[model samples]
Target: MNVLFNTDKLTRLIANLQTFTGIRTNTFDAAGKDIQLSGGHSDFCRLINASPEGHARCEACDARAVEKCLTARNAYSYRCHAGACETVLPVFESGTPIAYLVFGQLLDDSSVKQQWENAEKELGWYQGDLAELKEAFLRLRRFSPREMAAYAEILEALAQYIQQEGIIRSAEYSDLQKLEMYLDRHYMENLSLKRISADLHMGTTKLCTLSKKLSGGRTLTWLIAQRRVNAAKSLLLKSDEPVSSVAESVGFSDYNYFTKIFKSVTGITPSAYRKTNRS
Candidate 1:
């Protein structure tokens, strides 16, 4: 398959997968760890972020794979992540799996009859109930085999593009991270685009452009506000600090503004946040 490795095309491919297959694509750097996973109908992104599934399984499975790969050496596929029922496909470049594309377990025309038969065959050997499995199978959405092949081709192109374009190792995000880390450390201080730009030896306008790109289109001020709000979450969890105190600690001088922004981002007031955590 022809692969375009530029950023614009990569973003478009990711968007298309989300639109068509209802599956999300996650890319890793040269390392096996995930950089980001998005655009999936399943909340597997959230699960992978907080749960010990993919990487943990990969570590153990990597060693055991040599024995299993006796039948297939050219390409390797295995699914043991909590049996979440989604298939994970590894995208390789020069024989190394650099990115993983996840699809399947969706509800489609053939899944019902096929899964029921398979479940019955393995029912005595497997731990999960066949009825529950059937129910879960029926609930999910499925893509046709043609759709699967199309998505696979797009992902293969994306993987090739990532390897050739150096997108994974780009220094473009470093300055943004530096500014974010600086703000994280010194948010309580007087912070503005001017002061931060001066410190980083960048112009305010350029900084603004980078800020939007790096923060997923959130302006610099919004990013700071989000940081403050996130900090308030931690304080709510770990400290008995009053709402106003937590607000001040995170750089919001005005308690009302803090409450407004915190609620806007988290859908709960700071007081409610603390109370829920406490309860």
Candidate 2:
């Protein structure tokens, strides 16, 4: 049984999980768009951003992670091209692959030092580059094989949480499902309950009732916020647009109000989110 994820709830839960484990988590949709857990990139990831070549190498690591996770049908761990250990887990419900959860980007200090020397001597790393990375390299989190295995267990449990939280009776959402899909497609537009009701050819009262039921007690406004905020996240990460422009692009006209709602939804300002998540 496929399910459309509740992005807000799962993002909040993933945030708490990251805090608990001191490990990062990221989720991506089937289309490869990040829907939740978009930030908190590890220092190993940062080091790879030092150059275009290094960034390409980092992409290789990410591709490897994705392939391993999907192929294994469970958690997959490997040493990244940047000398850090990483893991990814495929998220599936009822045999349909919908998303992925990635975790554990950690570097061993000694391994990093050796790789740094090798990079400088063989890979054309600049004179001051490796030195500049010393701090973040030393600070990069490390985990043993056994520990990563344990983290995989924890991630397995959390993956179940996302699946279970998304579980709702399908019979109750026939009309609501169509509405939900429409909202997801057009959430960037100026939408209203009245407009939606008219388009659905249903009475306002009936629309409101069905909306409440579909949202599990949330109003349609909540649905809008969820869609817009997630869209804002993708924009903030994928481009260098200004926060105000990003706000407007996501259907939030008032910059201040957008900042307030963005912080409320993501626990960080738009600027901070971009800074943390940008490649």
Candidate 3:
């Protein structure tokens, strides 16, 4: 769960983006912790967040947006509960999402009147100066649909730049840790390189590379076989199950292949290992 990045440089870049685009930008880590890089929230949002209920709703809205973006694996745009437009773009490293770039807090020019009416209805639940809130809401920067699309493109490019520049990355050790954990949990199932790669949201080649690194230069198949053999050894010593049963229980469908792999890994057949290790 360790994230590495240059905070100062990221903050500077976000700030400059905000200055140029008139749209605030922020980043959220995989765990959904916000890293506020650009300037503060817009005056309209600030007024809404001032109320306790408004703050809670805003948090929930953001969480839902982030979840949708992660599921879509692309930029997601939506109108917030308070009626401002926002977009969330996920940042990925080697097919794994590491962070998100959230930009937008403007009024869509075509929908301003409707948005204002909706915001006024929702604002009744919040204890704020209604007139001041309305004024701030009206003052929010407005964008046409085409302009919003342009900003979305800009944010998408920025996300790629962030990855290329290593503005955010999951540590190599963490990557290895996750890979090992996944293998440990599912070694007994029917496993394959494509399945594991897809489940881990990693490329097949990268999965193989990390597996080799984890197993001290062995291939990913070796790691899986090693896990299955280790489990088979435990079963052989602890239980009197038949050799075929033990192999099958540990994901070895073919008993003969299991024997081959067990000998390769443990330097003995399963039965021999059990007999020698047992009291």
* Best TM-score among the predictions, by candidate number: 3
How many clashes in each structure?
5, 0, 0
Candidate 1 runs further than 4 Å off: 1-170
The residue-by-residue lDDT of candidate 1 on 137-165, one tens digit each, is: 45556665566566566655665666666
| Residue 262 lDDT in candidate 2 | 89
- Candidates ranked, most accurate by TM-score first: 3, 2, 1
TM-score of each: 0.42, 0.53, 0.62
How much does candidate 1 score in TM-score?
0.42
Whose TM-score is higher: candidate 2's or candidate 3's? 3
Per-residue accuracy of model 2 over 179-249 as CA lDDT, tens digit each: 88888888989899889888878778877787787678988888888889999999998888899999999
Candidate topping lDDT: 3
The lDDT for every candidate, in the order shown, is: 0.60, 0.72, 0.87
**Candidate 3 local lDDT, 1-279, one digit each (tens):** 678777998999998998887888889888656776668998988888887899899888888999998899998999888888898888888788899888777888776778899878866687778888888898999988788888888888888999888788778756787899999999999999999988988898889889888989989989999899989988998899999999999999999999999998889998889889985
Q: What RMSD does each model have against the real structure? A: 18.1, 19.3, 12.7
- Please list the residue runs of candidate 2 whose C-alpha ends up more than 4 Å from where it truly belongs after superposition: 1-5, 31-36, 50-52, 108-128, 167-176, 179-279
The global Cα lDDT (0 to 1) of model 2 is 0.72
